[model samples]
Target: MAVLNEEQEMLRDMARDWATNKSPVTEFRKVRAAGEPQAFDKGAWNTMAEMGWAGVIIPEAYGGSDFGWLSMGLIVEELGKTLTASPLVASTIAASAIILGGSEDQKSTWLPRLASGELVATLAVDEGPRHAPHSCSTSVSGGKLSGTKAFVQEAHGADLFVVAAKDGLYLVEKGDGVTLSTRKLTDQRSHAEVTFDGTPADSLAGGGESLLDDVLDRARILTACEMLGMAQQVFDTTLDYLKQRVQFNQVLATFQALQHRMADLFGDLAMMRSAVEGGLQALDSGFGVARAATIAKSEANRVLHTMSREGIQLHGGIGMTDEYDIGFYLKRARVLEASWGSSAYLRDRFAKLGGY
Candidate 1:
């Protein structure tokens, strides 16, 4: 049971209240119906940025709140309850990469912009189906980058791209030969297959290949935090439906078998909470973050997958219908499971990290 400090609890409360009032589940459904990846209200995004969510993890010098990973996770958990869609995850992870490994100049240049929501950035790493960081097919030549990055979240709308290429990590502008073609995914967010053909890029002066490993681990942990939020939402939604939905002349929640199922889901959710919180603590405490992040992400992936599936299944026919909100959650969960890395992939990495 990880406890939130005063500031953290305040931030959580703020996020929960804002998400409930400004960007509720109904708003998300409306956005999905409009065929937009960003179901989040633009006004709500601006409000969040004003609340310092955009800069929650950034240093204060960079116009940020510098709240740290735990605070960021708390906000994300609240956002997940509504399946809110914003560039929060991408921007935070990208900014963290710069903060952890970028030169002072790089941090000064990008961190403030990211923190202020003046720029939206995403990590472009994957070239194919596999989400392994070492599997980068994107290469660089003569200060130029050339490769395709598929499934790039928010690519269609991002202002900057933090691309991982063979020559190291490069920040490339979104123009010229950098072609972004949007793909409609199940999660209803705008993803794209980004092709960089000799695009002009600036290398992070201080960060080399080693930074790639660090960035990926950080991204995985951040993603796990988001998944934790998504899983909790699914559980809550399913629980609410069970209590209200009548079956066999009684509420579904009244059945002992169903109670056991909910208990199992609660246990899984608890485990995910432990893993994510532990990973955040490890990262904040300057402990060995790679192994901790891998374990957290792997555990999150497994539990989220199970919770999403069971959530929909328990909802029965209504779950399969697009009109129902549980279907949206299921879709988003599936996408998140496939993103970063699948359960099997992360589990394998975790096993190797243990030297098993």
Candidate 2:
């Protein structure tokens, strides 16, 4: 784990306390029950912003703390533990796009509102399913953007969209030609297929050709942070269950076979944490981010896939039931594994980046 500064430690502890007490899985259950198109509690999101999470990576000039990416990852990780339903990750990724590529006037117009949580933003990139950023067909013409983006997270109530086009990234507001079609993803969080037809777009004119790639690396790392948290929670919960759950007149934890499985899972969790933290540190240091992101998210996909499955298997029948929270993590894990990139996708990208 990366060593935390005193402020970062405080922020992580506070987020842990809030997610444990204020917005537990029960709160998420309520949000799931509500079935709103936005799919998260506006009041809870307001609290997150009020506590400075919305501005972790934003500059002080733009009313943000400018705390950097690792700090943002800490908050995201804790929220992931309880499956907190919010657009914090999506909005932060969108803001990072602007921070990387937006012009001065554009930043002045948008970043402060984003920092203060007065507006919510999300990235719209993939045209089809499976996160193909290179295959983006969205186009800009005469200052109007057009095309369809599929599986856009946090789309329903977003005020701005940082859209990727065939040429570059553009900022499009949620008006005029913009329309959203809700997608009932298994996780039941906010997701949509957003379509644009002649929507006015403001191009982000900085950061050269690599801006989208850079922003995506941030997305991959931060997302891996969430997955890391989920994996850790599953491990801890499963271990506890083994200790208490009696089987064949003995605690499952006493069985040699079960003990070995838990030990292996413990090792995987540690490796996942290391890779994820390394990715975040890379973002902060401005070095080797793409490779680090690939490793982080790839490890996250592999480990979480196993962790969620094993959690259910070890828990037996109740694990798959709707009443159990472990089942919910499995559903959410599938969505996240496919988002940003899948294991196969990341491996291919890593090979190409390695010039192999």
Candidate 3:
């Protein structure tokens, strides 16, 4: 496990308590059952806002605690354990772009609203079937933007969008010329395809490919933290089941073969934790962030892919059923694995960054 300071520990404990008790996986199941339009629990989101969790990384000047990236990662990890569906991660990453590239006026306008959770925000990148950032062909002309952004997280409720264009990143609102079509994710979370037709937009001053890369690196690190959470949760649940589940008049946990499999999982979990912690440390220290993030996400993607598959197989026939919560973890793992960049994409990116 990674070392946590007093503050990070407090934040993590608070988030874990709320996620596990107040809004557990059952709560998420209820949201899916009702087919919530936003695809997340609104009351729970409001509760998180009230807890100041929506702005963990924002500066105090922007109505945030300015707790830094690790603090935010800790919160994300806890929420991931229960598959808590919220806009915190998306909004935080969007705010990061403005903080890094926005003009004084733009920062003053958007940061406070985002920090207060008064406005939900998201990033719209990736226009293709694969995770190709350079393949962005979106155009901006005469202050009007025309493009299509696929698989945008939390787009259903996002009040603002940070769109990637050929020249730079632009800020577009949820108004005229902007249309959103939902793409139902395997995990039942919200992801949308957004189309803009000559939509009026304001350029984020100083924003360019480099700034976009930095923002994405930070987002990747955060995603790794969340995956670490999910992996741990699945392992714990599986281990408990093995201890109690009887097969052939013997507890599965006592079988040597099953024990070895779980032991390997435990080892992999440790390595995943190290990668995630290293990525957080890199971001916090302002060094090697891109490389650290790539390594972390790639390792996490690999670990979760294995854990999700093994978790289902260990659960026997019930694991494949929708009635079982274990299956949801596998579905979410697949979505997240492909979201920012798959393991293959990240490895290639790392190689290119290393001039290989």
Best by lDDT: 2
Backbone clashes under 3 angstroms, per model: 1, 0, 0
Give the clashing residue pairs of candidate 3, or none: none
Model 1 score (lDDT)? 0.84
The per-model lDDT (C-alpha) reads 0.84, 0.94, 0.90
lDDT minimum window of 10 residues, candidate 2: 128-137
> Candidate 1 deviates by what RMSD?
1.5
Error of 2 at 160 (Å): 0.4
User: If both were scored by TM-score, which would come out higher, candidate 1 or candidate 3?
Assistant: 3
Candidate 3 RMSD to the correct structure: 1.0
After superposition, the stretches of candidate 1 with alpha carbons farther than 4 Å from their true spots are: 36-40
Rate residue 167 of model 3 by lDDT.
86
Per-residue lDDT tens digits for candidate 1, residues 1-356, read 67879998898899989888888888777776777544445676777788889998899998998888888988887888888888898888888778876888888899998998888888898888768777777888888889999889888668789898776788888889888777787888879999999999888756555787778777888888888988998899899999999987999999999999999999999999999998888778769888888888889888998999999899998799877887887788778887777888887877877898
TM-scores of the models, in the given order? 0.96, 0.99, 0.98
